[model samples]
Target: MGTRVSIAVVSVAVTAVALAGCAGEVSDVERAQAKVSASEDAVAEAQDAFDAASDEFCQAGESYIEALDRYGDVLNETAPTVGDVRTAGADLVEPRDDALDSAQAAVDTQADLVSAEQELADARAELAAAEAGPTGTPAPVDTAMPSASPLAPAATVDRVDQAESEFDAALSAVTDDTPLSDASELFNSAAVELEMAWLRLFADAGCLADEQQQQAEAAVRAYTTALQQELTTAGYYTGAVDGIYGPLTVEAVESLQEAQELPVTGTVDKATAEALQAELIALGGVAAQDAVASTAAVQQTLKLTGFWDGPVDGVWTPELTEAVAAFQVELGVEPTGTVDAATIAAFEQAISELQQATPTPSPSSSDG
Candidate 1:
């Protein structure tokens, strides 16, 4: 009887030990799974942050590009002397420096994204290892990280640095009162360099759409034509109204550039374009400028009012002429292709009405 009791006690003890071991194993697995879940959540949060940073960076880059465009406009025009160039460069210094800061921020954000991606990858590996059970080693993680962007990190950094250097060089050239001719070359080089940098950044960041580049190019050409027209109206140019940048056009452009105190490149640069626009505006509002600038403004205004479908390239095609005439009829004005003061006022009124009628969305409504 004593022996049997001892045997029964031993059996109960063995069963309890076995049950405890199983419970401990289950607890370990549960803990590991929880850890993996937490890590996955962290990874998701990091990814979202990275994406937001990337978006901000891209936006900053675009703004910088716009600033550059404005600066380029000023730089490409004719400046009578070194002092004029220096003054123009001074006007752009603040904006150019701001752009540089934005570019640096973008590069920093990109680095942050790379780090976040690495953390996410590490978390995934940990999760995988946890799922492999006791005595199972995790698979080797790939050390060579891959980027979806066309530009590698090293290349991106290099390009950004080069762009900064080029911009600095250009700014220095202007600020130092370099000869207008020499400064023009430096400015052109800087612009080209910065453009290359922007191209790479835009492509890598997935921000530059094919249509955007085309539209930019078209806008530039249109601005050039507008400049030519303004010069012609001012009695500086006698070339054809065609948008070609030929020798005659160059001479005319140089003359205008000299008058406006811009660096003379004989090309329709950003400064030249703006000077022309300002001159046109000063002449008598959008309606009083020579055909191209006037027509372009009217076309843009009409488009804003939902009456024109043509490109705003300063071209007076028959379709545009017809569109203008139709707009005129609607406004109870004479069906002349010319945009007179009455038509201009009517267009402005329509634009104001459209803007006022459009509802401003609430923040809460947009949150979803």
Candidate 2:
């Protein structure tokens, strides 16, 4: 009876051990399967995230390209007047800034996609290891896919930067108190730089070459029109504000030259431009109305008679008054600085005497 009881206890112990071993094997399999399932879910989630990131990257790339194209258009716009230049320049600021922002966003989105793809690969590798009982190496992670749009070339980027700078300078030139000619020169120079940039882009995208060239030509014409408009405002140009420098425009230029005592070249030279600007400023006030003609005449007479040493620009300054007083005292007239009929008669008589006393030299005999 004792031997039977001991055998029975040993049998129970063996049965219990077998049951525990089966449960342990089952739990191991379940744990491995759960790990694989979780890894797959993680990989799927990562893939979804990567896909979303790629979409965002592509969208941002498109936005940047659009902004760049708009900026190019602004640079190529025809700004015929100061107002036109100002408006076009103002329009450029927003797109220029947006392009910069979108470029950075695209780069950032690409980075996020790369990271998400890496996470997915890691999860897949984990899943493989889990399934294979951690014995073999997992597959290699794939490289990140290429982006929809290639990165802008360094030269292209540089050109955009230069264009922005030049555009800003051109805007400032017109908005400030810069002279008309100086502003026009600045605009022309900025346009030239912008055209160079556009040409570089056209080299890559030949389809846009003709349009860009036409736009550039238009811009040049606009600058010419601006010059004509400025000259017209100065009362030196009576011709149409057409961009062409025709005979009428040349005649107006000659008129300006004669007024400013410059060489009568009938051309819009730098000196002519400066003179026109000065005349415009002078014409802005009553000084242009010939209202001070009497004062100017007195000053001219005083200067010719060696009494006044001031400009005869029609300003009733204190020096001019003093000069008048001196002339009156010398002529034994009332010392009042004001001019009247008596003063004018005295000045005319003095001028007549001086002219008669001056000996007329015989003209040199011409050689036969």
Candidate 3:
């Protein structure tokens, strides 16, 4: 009886050990199966994301293509105006950028989908090995997958750049047949482009090692100053010939534009410049313009010396002539009512002497 009881206990112990081992093996296989399910879900989610991104990319690409077509239409128009071309080019910038951004997103999501598919494949292989026991060879995973390639961003960039170049060329192609307002529009467009290009190239710190920025700005400023000078000669601008494009300059430009039957945008454009040149030509060209500016300077100088109280307009009257003659006499120069190089030299010398003779006042002592 004792031997039989011992045998039964040993048998029960062996059965329990076998069951436990079986449970552990089943758990491993179940866990691998669970991993495969999770990987499949991940792949599904990545695929959905890729689909959405692809749709967005397609829409953006279509819109960009339409924008390009519109731009082409504007360029191909017979007798197209400057304003029309400029507006079309401006409109193309946004859609082109949108398409590029969408294409990049689509490429990135495609890469994600590819990666997720690889993970799923690996998980399935692992699950198969787990089900087949320790001696079974795992199925091969597809590791040699193609990488996600970029779609149209590079070609789009090149095409857009070419379009912008062509647009700029079209804007600058001026001829005698171009209308006055259209010519002004071209100038306005070119000036805006130059300003934007300058900001992009030189507005940041350390963009250039030297004074190129200042020189570039000064070049534009020189043009403004010359414009003001011409407007002064035309009896439009009465303000100082400073390079600043102030409200006075705008007002003068508008007045000139209105008189010439051009658009009154208050900007110093090519038409306004031509009108100013015509006015100068009517007044006897560069020589007359210089004389007017010099006369205005002489009038200011006479007012400073208390020899004249007339308005410092560039117009010459008997009052200005008498003032010049008196000033020449005071400076021991010939009493010429007309201003020449000698009169200008004599006035400059007199002013220098006057400045030197002026006394500097000392500060007063404080009482304790």
Candidate 4:
């Protein structure tokens, strides 16, 4: 009976040890399976995203292709007018930009999908190893994220920026002397290169857009108007300030450029604008000097009349403004802080009255 009891106790001890070992193995497998499940969920989400992106890309591409076909059809016309060709070209810009943007999104999502699939495969292998037992060794999976598409590198973006600037410079170089055909060819070629560069940078053809060109032209027109006004003030321009950049304005700009010893680009470049600004400053300084002289004269007159107690300095200080206002009040005129036509007329009358009111000495013979 003692031997049988010892054998039963040993059997119970062996069963407990086996159960513990089984539990540990099951825990490891459960953990690994959970990882695989999560990875699969991630893959499903990535695939959905990729599918949506691809659909958008396809739709955008089709729209752009249709627009391009229409443009080509216009060009293929037997007698396509300049206006027709220009309108067609303008219509193509937005669709092309949208297609490019959609293509970039698709490429990004595809990369994500690829990365997710790799992770899921790795997870599945890990689960298989966990289920195989302690002797099984899983091959290491590369968990590193893939690098970005080479098209979207910083260096490529920089190149695209440079290309855009060059295109702008080319557009600015156009003038009356540039032949229409030559200009068209130059712009068309540059635009193609610029569009391609933008695609590589995962961006739109901003520099090639008609809206951008219109904005630039509007800015230049405004600058030209201001330039014409300045030139007219400086005695260089004799035409009306109609804001139309005609030959007269061009001639005036050239004359000013010659006077300033700048390069004779009739259009107002940076140096030309700076020269005009300098002219404006110089003219303002002369006008300011004249105003100061006039103010000093007025202050002297006011001092003689005993209406002002301040010094005859040309600086129009608060004291000067107050004194002027006070003098205006006494003269039955609106008390404006600065001199105006009405104020000047009142000053003339005051000076006349003060001169007449003065008692002139007879001869002062004894005093002499």
Q: Which numbered prediction scores highest in TM-score against the true structure?
A: 1
lDDT of 3 at 273: 49
Q: Which candidate's lDDT is highest?
A: 3
Ranking by lDDT: 3, 4, 1, 2
* Cα deviation of 222, candidate 2, in Å: 27
Give the C-alpha miss distance for residue 137 in model 1, angstroms: 8.1
Q: What is the C-alpha lDDT profile of model 4 across 61-146, one tens digit per residue?
A: 55654564444345334455566655666786699689768867877777776776666676677777888778967655565654
Name model 2 segments beyond 4 Å from true: 1-79, 139-150, 175-368
Candidate 2 lDDT, tens digit per residue, 1-368? 22233334334544554576675654433443443444344445544554554445334433433443333334334435555556655565565455456555544544544444454444455545555565666556454542434344566656657665755665675654545443343344344444334333323322222443333333333434555666667766685553433334455666778978987655443455456556655776643453344345445556545565667664556666667667766654555664422333233223212332222332111110
| Native-to-model Cα distance after best TM-score fit, residue 343 in candidate 3, in Å | 69
* Shift in Å, residue 279, candidate 1: 42
Residue 305's C-alpha lDDT in candidate 3?
Answer: 55
lDDT of 3: 0.53
Model 2 CA lDDT for position 54: 44
Inter-residue clash pairs, candidate 2: none
Clash counts for the predictions, in order: 10, 0, 0, 0
Please list the residue runs of candidate 4 whose C-alpha ends up more than 4 Å from where it truly belongs after superposition. Answer: 1-26, 72-86, 132-136, 139-179, 182-368
lDDT of predicted model 1: 0.52
Worst 10 residues of 2 by lDDT: 359-368
C-alpha lDDT of candidate 2 relative to the true structure: 0.47
